[model samples]
Target: MKLLLITAIEEFEKDVINILKNSRLKAFSYQSVKGFKNDKNEMKNWFGKDDIAVDSLLFTVFSEYNCVDSIYKNINEFNSMQQTVPHIHIVTINLEDENFR
Candidate 1:
């Protein structure tokens, strides 16, 4: 088994969920999170800030390797058709031991 972590801005929550469902992901968990970026140039706004915070979501999925691969493919297709900067990010970690009860 592997641990898949997917993160995206809240605005794309529905789309992300759809991707997971289409991938046949049986179970998963997600939570609201604050995403931060430290880009001085992009921070030059009316408030004159050095950083910015974005409302985001983090999804955790534990599944087999094939399932994880399917999710990655789906997310890549979704991101390619986007015309914005924020896109879904996915990472997978190898689980040394899969015993979880």
Candidate 2:
């Protein structure tokens, strides 16, 4: 198994979720988060307001490595077809083992 993590703009969460679901990749977890780029000072537009401080949607999914391609494709499509926005991090790692509640 493998783990996939994606951090993207908040407004895109719903679209991301839909894309994931449509891709037949279910059984995942997600949350909304507030964060900023390392060069926030350079991106003055993101400063001075709580609402515009930079918020993103984070999603975590555990699946076969092949699933990564589909997810990445979906995300890329979403970004290109929609308005360009915040930074995103896509982390994929092997899952040695697991326990769940």
Candidate 3:
């Protein structure tokens, strides 16, 4: 079992979801977040009144390590095909076990 965390820009939220869907990922979670990066990492045009920067975060877990490969491939493909700064960040955590009631 494994856990996949995807933190991406708001604009790519839909793309991420679509990619997950295409990969047959059925269970996942998401939320809208408001935060700011460092001065150098800050967005060039993310200011919206008072210069606040916000973004969306998506998280999902897979029962198999192999299942994650497809999503990673899709994300890589998207990243390679697009010309954008601040690419999405993906974190993978290996789970020892999971209990579901």
Sum up the clashes in candidate 1.
0
lDDT of 3 by residue, 1-86 (tens): 77898877788888888887887765778787764655644554232223447665655656466668988888888878777664
* Model number with the top TM-score: 1
RMSD of each: 4.6, 4.2, 4.0
Instruction: Evaluate all candidate structures by whole-model CA lDDT and list the values in order.
Output: 0.81, 0.69, 0.70
Task: Give residue 58's lDDT in candidate 3 (0 to 100).
Answer: 57
Candidate 2, residues 1-101, lDDT tens digits: the string is: 88888776776677778877876775889988776545645644332234444667779888766678888887777656654445345678888887742
lDDT of 1 by residue, 1-101 (tens): 88999888898899989988888878999999987767766623212234667788999999877788789988999889887777888889999997776
Better candidate by TM-score, 1 or 3: 1
Which candidate model has the greater lDDT, 2 or 3? 3
The segments of candidate 1 whose C-alpha lies over 4 angstroms from its true place after superposition are 39-50
TM-scores, one per candidate: 0.85, 0.72, 0.76
Model 2 ranges off by over 4 Å:
40-52, 87-89, 99-101
Comparison by lDDT, 1 against 2, better one? 1
